[model samples]
Target: MADDLKFSAPPVMRSHPVNPTEPIDTLPELLNHLHQAAYVEMSTIPMYLYAAFSIETRGYSQWDPGVGASRLIRSIVVEEMLHLTLVRNLLVALGDGADVTFYDDKFMPKYPSTMLHRSPPLLLHLGKCTPDQVRDVFMEFERPKPDPLDPPPPDGWYATVGEFYRAIEDGLRRLDQTMGAKLWAGNQPDLQYVAAYWNRDGGGKPLLVHDLQSALDALKTIVEQGEGLEPGEPTVPVDPVHPKAGLDELPHYTKFQRIAEGIEGIGTLHDFRTDPHAGDYAADAGLTALNTLFNAAYSYVMHMLDVIFRTSWKDLKPGESNFRYHLERSFISAMQGILVTLAETMAAVPAGPTFEYYALPEQGKQAHLIELCDKAMTYFPQLGGDNSVRWLLAKLPDV
Candidate 1:
C-alpha cells in the first residue's frame, strides 16, 4: 500500500535576504527570523558531529591535541543543542509549534555552501572539518562578525550569530512597544528546559521569552556561548556542566581555532578539506545498506522529538511519559551507533567514495512523526538488526 502522508507548509527557515539591513517590524517577520534561528542552530551540529565522530575512535582522548580537538568539537555540538532549544522556546512563545523533522530545502546545507550568501563565502561541507577546513571554512562561518565591504545585509543578517540574534532582540523590543506582554502569547513556561534535559548537562536555562528581558537574556546566552563577549577575541570558561570546568573551555569558534593551532603547533596541518566529503563514511559512497539504516535511525530521532514537542509532558500518563522518555533515550543512543555503523562501512569500502545521509520519503516529513515511527518499527530488522530487538524489548509497556 502506498504510504499516506500530507505535511503542513514547512516552517519558514530563511536567514538572509537582499535587504538584510531591513529591520524586522512585524510578527511574521519575527517568526520568520526565529525559524531561521532554529535552522541556523541546527545546521552546525551535524557538521561538528561528523568531524568529532570521524576521528579514529581509539585516538579520542589519546594524543593531547587530538583528544583536545575531539572534545572541543563535541562540546560545541552540545551547546548548539542549547541554542536550538532556546530558538524553539522562542517560537512556541510566539505561538508556533516546533518541528525537528522539518528538513526543508531552505537552509538545508549544501557543501561548498556559504551560510548567508556572503562575499568570499565560507564554503561548507558535511565531512571531517580539519585544519585547513576549520580555518578557511568553519572559522569563517563563526567569525566574530562579517566584513563591511561584502554588504551590510550580511552584517545585519549574515554576520556573527550573535549579531543575528541581536537583530531578533531589537525586533522583540520594537514589537513589545506595540504588543506589550501580549507578545509572549506563545510562551510555554513548562516546556522550557532545565539542567535535566542535558542529562544533568549543567547548562543554564533554555531561552524562555515571557518578556523583553527574558528574550534578550536568551539571545545573550546564545551569543556569549558561541561567539564570546568581544569580537574576534577568545573567552574560555569552565564547561558549566563539569565539576572542575573552571575557566577551561572555549566557545565554538575558539575551539576550532584551538584544533587548528594545536595541529600547527604539533608541526602538521589539521587540514579539514578542499571540499567536503563525508570523510570516508559518506552514505553517498557505495555503502547502500549502511546508508539506508543510518538514515532510518536518524529519522526515528526526529519522530521521537516530534512526540515530545507536540504533546506537553504533563499531559502524558506515567506509562506514556516513561515510554516516551526511554524511546527518546534509545533514539539518542542510536544516533552515535548509526555513525559507528557508517564508520565501519567506510573502513570496509574501497577508496575514494562517499556516503550521503538521507531519510526517505517513506520516512515521512515534519508532521507524520508518530506514523513514521510505526512504519520505521516494521523495518527495524533490516535497519538495525539485533539492536532493534533490544529497542523493541525496552519499549514494551506493562499492561
Candidate 2:
C-alpha cells in the first residue's frame, strides 16, 4: 500500500499535533511523533549548514575549510543528517514510509521559527557563524538537562530533547507490549539504510531498525549525540585534532559551546543576509541562477533518498543494477562537492545559500538538474571546472 502512494504524497493530516509530553498510546500517535522527530532533525540541517557556510575561508587551507569552526559545524551537520536518516528508517520500519517531500510549505520551517511544540520557545535563525548564534540557538537546541535540584519543565513540555526521546522510547515499549508481534509486522528490513550503503567516515554508521531493541538503539544514538553525554557519563576530553573521533567523541552541544565561549577559534565569518530565500535574489540574475542550481541539486538529494527508502530489492533490473548504491554515492557527492562548493561560492559573493522548498519536476529530473548547472555556470563559471558538475549530474537518478 505504501508503494502505491505517490513519491511526493500530500502531507499526512495527523489526528493531533506532536506534543511530546502527552502519551503516545496509539499507533497513529506514535507514527505522528516519529514524523515530528524527523522534521526536527531535517529542520536543523539547513540552519546549521547556513552558519557553517557563512564562515570566511579565504586564507584557510582548502583541507581545513573555515578553520576549526566551519569544520566542526559541518561535522555536526553530517551527524544531524545521520540523525535524520535514523529517524526516517524508524518511521519506515514502523510502516509510515519515507516522506521526503521537503518542498511542501507545511513540512519546511519558516525562518526565525521556533521548534515544533517546544516550550519557552527559542527562535531559530539562519545566518553567519557568530558566538551569539552558537550559544543562543545552536547550543540551546541540544542543551543538557537542568541540574536535578531544579524543577522540571511544565507538565506538557520536555526539559530537553533527550527527555522527549526517552518518552518516545517509553511509548514504544508500551505499544510493543500491547500490540505484540503485529506492531513490527510492517517492518521491512531490506528497505532500511544500513552502514554498507553509507560511505562517509564521520557520524556513526546508520543503524537498521527492525525490532524494538534496535529501534531504541537508534533513538539512543539521536539523543546522546545531540546532547553531549548520557546521564552520569563522564565528559570525554575534546580531541582538537580529531573532534568526531569515535563513539566517545565530543557531542554536538559541546562543540558549539566551545566555539561560543571562544574555547575554539572560528576565525572570521562573512555577514551574509539572515534567512535568505530564493525570491530574495530575484533582482540579481547571478545570485538567482546560483540559488536555483543549488536548490535543484539539494532537492534532487532528497528525491534520491526518498527513492532509496521506497524502492524494493527485487526492482533492481539489468540497467538498474546497484541503483541504490549509486544513489547513495551520488547523494554524498552532491552534498560534499556540489552543494558545499556552491554554498561557499555564494558566501564569497556575500550571499547565503537559501535552502528553500523546491522539488524537482516529476519527469526528467536529472536532465533538468544538468540544465540548471549550465544556466548557473553562465554566471558562476567556477562551477563547471573539471566537468565536476556533469560528472555529479550523470550519477543522479531520473526519478
Candidate 3:
C-alpha cells in the first residue's frame, strides 16, 4: 500500500543546464516557450492536491484496481510544487515576475472539448460544478493514454513530453547559431545564463550544471550575476556571429506579454503536431517528438486529477455551500486529491503483472513525477489569489 511507503522532504534545489552564449534570433519566441513551460507547471499543483485529498478523505479502501497510485500522485504533487518554484526562480533570473492573481471563474484555462475525446463522460462535465465535482473533473485529466503515440487532436501534439523538451533544445541550438555572442551580452542576466546552459547541453550529454551536486554553485552564479539559475551550464564557448559587437538592445516586452506569448507558442506547437495535414509547420521533425512526450505526461497528470475530482464531488450531494467559500479552495482540494492519487498509483505499480507489461520502473516514476511538477510550477504565481490563500487551500481537509 502507498500508505506504508515512507515520505521524505524534497530537496530544496536542483540543477538545470542551458547554453548562455547562444543567441536567440527570436528572443520573444524563446521567452514565450519558457512562459508556456512555466504555465504548465503552475497549472498542475491544484490537480495533485485534489487527488491527495480524495484518496485520504474518500478512503482508498474502496478501490482495488491499484495500490501505489495515491503515493505516486503525492510524490508527483510535491515535485510539481518544486517545478513551480524552479520555473519561478528561472523567470526571476530572466527578469520576469509571474502574476499570481485570481480572476473570474470563467478565466480558468479552458480544456478544449476536442482534447476530451477519449475521456470518460463523468470526467468531461465540469461547468460550474461544486468543489468535489471540480476535483472529479480532473480525475481523467492525468490518466495515461494507452497509446500516447496517437494522441487525440487539439491536445495531442508531438508524441510525448520528452519530445516537447527536444523542441526547446532545437530552438536553443538555432538561437545559438543565429544570435551567438549578442545573445550572451544581454543585461537580462538570467536569459544569458540559460542560453549558455542550453548551448552546452545541446549535444545531449548531461551537463554538470544540471547535476544535483552543482545546482547550488550554478544558482550562486545566477544570483550573483542577477541571472536566473540555468538548469545546466554550457561546455562549448559560443561563436561570435553578430557583425555589430555591442548593439544597444531594445527593451523587452512586459512580463505578462512574454508569458502569454510563451503559452501561445506551446499551443501552436501542439496544433502543428496534432493536425495531420499541418505540412511544413507541423512538428514532423526536430523537437516535435519531445513535445508529444511532454503533452502525454502532462495529460496523464491532468487525468489523475479528473478522476479524484469527479469521484469526490459525486459523493457529495448537490446544493452544498462548500462550493461558495472560494473557488480557489476548491482548486486546492482538487490538487490534494491529485497528489493522493499519484502516490497510490505509484505504490500499486509493483503489485501486478501489468507493471511488467508497462515496464515502468520506480526510478522512472520518480523522474516522471519530478518532470511533471517542474513543468507545472512555472505558472503557479500567475494564478489568482494570494499565495497564502493558495497554500492554505492546498492544505485543506481532503474530504
Best by lDDT: 2
TM-score-better candidate, 1 vs 2:
2
Of the candidates numbered 1 and 3, which has the greater lDDT value?
1
- The local distance difference test score of each candidate is 0.54, 0.74, 0.30
Q: How would you encode candidate 1's per-residue C-alpha lDDT over 1-399 as one tens digit per residue?
A: 001100211223222322345888888778777777776777676666666545544344465535456556756777787787777777777776553333434434444444542334344566554576678767766777766765554234355666677878889899999898778876766554432345232234454467777777777767767776677556634333222544544666776777777642222223233334444344442343344444544545444554555545455675454544554455455444444444444433322112233454553333332233334345333333455423442342211
Regarding TM-score, does 2 or 3 come out ahead? 2
Candidate 2 structure quality by residue, lDDT tens digits, 163-255: 777778988999999998888888887777774444343456688788898888788778777785654454432322224645356688887
- Angstrom error of the Cα, residue 23, model 1: value is 0.9
Best by TM-score: 2
In angstroms, the error of model 1 at 375 is: 16
In the order shown, the candidates' Cα RMSDs to the true structure are 7.7, 6.1, 22.9
Worst 10 residues of 3 by lDDT: 350-359
What's the best-to-worst order under lDDT? 2, 1, 3
| Residue 77, model 2: Cα distance from true site in angstroms | 1.0
Provide the global lDDT of candidate 1 against the true structure: 0.54
Clashes within 3 Å, all models in order: 17, 0, 123
